[model samples]
Target: MRRPPQELWETDVLTFRKMRNLLPKYVFKSLENTIKQRTKLDVSLAPIIATAMKDWAISKGASFYAHIFYPLTNITAEKHDGFLSVESDGSAITEFTGKALVQGEPDASSFANGGIRSTFEARGYTAWDVTSPAYVLETDNGVTLYIPTVFISWTGEALDKKMPLLRSNAAMSKAATRLLKLLGHSEVATVNSSCGAEQEYFLVDEHLAQMRPDILQTGRTLFGRPAAKGQQFDDHYFGAIPERVQILTQDIEERMYRLGILLKTRHNEVAPGQFEIAPFHEEANVASDHQQMIMTILKSTAKKHGFMCLLHEKPFSGINGSGKHVNWSVSNATQGNLLDPGDNPHQNLQFLLFCGAVIRGVHKYGRLLRAVVATAGNDHRLGANEAPPAIISVYLGKQLEDVFNQIKQGEVTSSAPAGVMSWDVPTLPEFPKDPGDRNRTSPFAFTGNRFEFRAVGSNQSVSGPLVALNTILTDSLTWVADKLEADLAKGIELDTAVYAVLRQIMDLHGNVIFGGDGYSEEWQTIAVKERGLLNLTTTADALPILKEQDIQELFETTGVLTASELKSRFHAYAEQYIEVIKMEADLVISMAKTMISPAASRHLSEVSATIMNLKQIGIELEQENAERVASLTNQMMDTVKNLGNALNEHNFTTIEEHMQYCAKTLRPMMDQVRKYADDIEGEVAHDLWPLPKYQEMLFIK
Candidate 1:
């Protein structure tokens, strides 16, 4: 049967409504109540829920179920279990109990735990996160029920990213709801932070991508020379989408929509063969899950179209890298967008207070914010002039900046108005968007009703950043609530109390707010030296901030993570950094010695023999080309030896020192090798080159 086009837009797979219709009325209502209240479903209710889930999966042709979890590695992990079971009579039967529906054991020691789990402590549990609906994933391997779960150690420690996010969300909700009541709003319930992540990525032909080892192993090209034509002309941004890419986009959207992802827009990006996808905002928890799904589906779907999707922050060296701009805001049913200025921003005391809370949060915990986005891939993008600077700063538009300045001085009399722009021709319609301009250079910018966290890497999970934002906002809102309570006790008017509380917040934290070019050196100096913001330029420098005393207290106070959990995260991230660099360094050395050298030597011999023939014929040519090739090859080989030597050194006093070596000593040595290798690439014949060139990989699709 032909389905209506609108039917394709509706969420069908594993959605709450689908289950609600599949199950008995009372049973589904009980399940809905449990999800809404964040409570455990009764054991009796679970059997009914489990049966309904199993029947739904069977209807979708799923013979197995997989428990999916997001671990510390910024990727999803799944363990599939078949439904077949043996009864006492030895007949085949499918059994799913409430207990089975709720829990499963996956090996924890195999995953990166930073010494948290030893070989003997291999037990880990995946408990159903009832809020994130389970969907039946379809693949050639066969249909399987995919359940979103929180991975945890048997001893009750959080062993995955989702746990912290859930905790942080709970903390933020409590604090926000308390503040709302203090401000005379009594009907507030379950306040949530929302996220709309703008995902940017590059699409390269799979055939070209496979030829590049770095692209295959590390999600980026490690040794490719610069493309002749980069994003220099500024023509690709918002340009027409390619036909092949458009097909891939439609396939991805179709799959994503069925899973309930609210995809909203698609377009070409600033760099050639690069594109972006954005979705309408949703609750942070669900939005992050959807973000991960989007990335997975993007790559898997592209492969079907013969394209390799590159999600690395900087896939190629000389062009604009990608970023996942996480648009964030907070609100509840009783309130609509706490950050919304609603025409007269200055007069909206509630908006000012909430916005002030964000300013304060960013200023006080900007280092934590920076730490969340730190990664080996992101190091090549952040503060590289095209992306936001490593230094964290908030960009409120000129009008909002002025309004805050007025509030700082004591009174806010008028707001910066968003005026209409009328075209000279009568046919064009008037536009009514706010006149406040957005600053792309700023790491965090307030756009309309939300803050876009532009510094987050393109390939990272949104959970870490969202957790930090929520926990910090919890702290800031707690501060506001305390001060407002004291002020109201003194018989001050609500508006007067809000202004005073916000004024104090602005006075203490307004240094983090800047509406200028964040990439400028002047801003860098002013930010670090004058304004007191930390510039953590590398993952090695930033990841350690996760264990800082202030950060420890921040997480502890909000119940987001314990001190031990934070330390474990620090160790895990450091371990990842070290492991990634070591692998890349090893790959670089192997490729240089084997692939690059052989290619270079072949070209050099061919050139030298041709020179000898020319000399015999009584004609002389410049031997500079031959000498340069030999010199570059020898220099690259020498650098490769140095990198190997550095990798062998294991005398680091601590993990931090080891990471510093990787970032400073090892990474630089690898780069030195790359410089010479890239030179050799230019000197060698393109037909003899073993790896794909950056231009071909970047522009061929």
Candidate 2:
């Protein structure tokens, strides 16, 4: 009996709404208190809370629970524990202890800890994050209680993305609170960062996905000639949703809503078979948890619908790659939205200062920001059509740019008010929403109330970028607070102090602000040569920035990440970069040899046979096609052998050197192999080709 989506709504989740109904008011309050105060679980109240959570889970048909954590890799990690316990008397009972609810042990060495945890010392802890609510995850076999958790080493170093994200948020909150207080806000609250990530992904036939080793292993096509009619015509953007996709979207939304995810919109993306789903803004930690789940659900639901979801940045060539536009801002209970420039000019002074702080942070840590999103998959998208260039810059729209320009020149005496767009006639409606045109090209753009960090790769976990953004902002805001305090102690007014701080920030870091097309090569050159900005175009260049002494000190001072933790993360990221590129290179070799070569060779054989037969008849059909096919097949084979030889050399003294070789030497070699392979694919016969064509994958399904 398939239930309609409306009837199935939240039926499988132990949401907060369900928790409210099951627990006593005070019991719920205790849980909230733990989240708000960062207090340890009250031992006496733990049983009560656990019982309520268990009851809610059982109501959703859950007989087991899983402590789900996001590890170094951008994927969900979980350890399922059954609720039933067999007694000595052979009786069975279901129970959940508060201690069990709060923590669990998982093997640390299994994750990408960058040698943080040795195989012998395989102990790791998963501490429950109550702020991100627990939920009931439904599977075909059974439902399980899913509690969001943070992974850490036995020695107390952060081993997972969530730990630093939470720590960074706390640091930012403290810094933002102090700054707000200095700005005359007495009733300050826990200012937390918020995010709204727009996830873009492609859907292809499951059969096709299963057949392609490249897509299966790399989440992208290693070799595919462009479709005859690609997105060049621009017909797919915001087009009507396919029926199958619509049903899948409905299923995913239902699952998300059940888990208390706040989904806002869905639409066809620019590339055919590509689409996007976005959630309304939520607290950064909770939003990251939901984002992981969103990706999970997208893949799981797509499987159910006979489609495979491709989150790879560039799943196919000759088309716009995917990106997760992470819209970020900070807010608190007292200050609804710290980034919001209120209508009143007097109140907006604080907003401008915070905005100025962001510019300063980005300018200072642009390389670090780029490092977080550096992946083999994303490198294809960063400077691609749908993505921002490698150079980091802030895009304040025309009106906001004008306001900031005035501030940089020493005084922001006035701000450009939102303009009302009139319809030229009395009977039409008017609006005031469009502040100015948006710059999609800018990697970091202030889109109204929030800054959209658009450079984040689609397949990445938002935790990394958020960790950097929050920590950097903390550094900048703390600097702003210190400067203002010094000026205030010298008897300066609040507005005067803020303006002075902003002026200094702009004068120093204002070069980061650009209101032009980021795609322009001229801007790229000017940004690096004239503006004194860091242009780290590759993971090899960017990841080293994480290990910089200043970056380590920044994290240590903010208490977001210790030096050891920073070192571990850098090693992990470097290893990941090396591993990812290696896998793709290996697959390119394998696919080119097994699939592409065979197909091209077979086509050549047929062409040679036809030409020879024509020569026998004394009717010379030109041998040009046969000659071309043979030449391409031979060239491709040689490149594959070259790539194979390159892959064999692994002796390296340092992680940095190894990563640089992969980035500089191995990557270009892989691209060279792909170039010939893709060219061979074009020349080869369609019927003889082993893998599905791009036209088939993109347009057919």
**What lDDT does each candidate get?**
0.89, 0.87
Candidate 2 colliding pairs: none
User: What TM-score would you give candidate 2 relative to the actual structure?
Assistant: 0.97
| Model 2, runs deviating above 4 Å | 1-11, 344-347, 424-427
Writing each residue's lDDT as its tens digit, candidate 2 over 55-78 gives 878877899999999988898899
- Which digits, one per residue and each the tens of the lDDT, describe model 1 over residues 10-29? 44467777877888898888
Model 1 vs. true fold: TM: 0.98
* Native-to-model Cα distance after best TM-score fit, residue 600 in candidate 1, in Å: 1.5
* Pairs of residues at least 3 apart in sequence or in different chains that clash in candidate 1: none
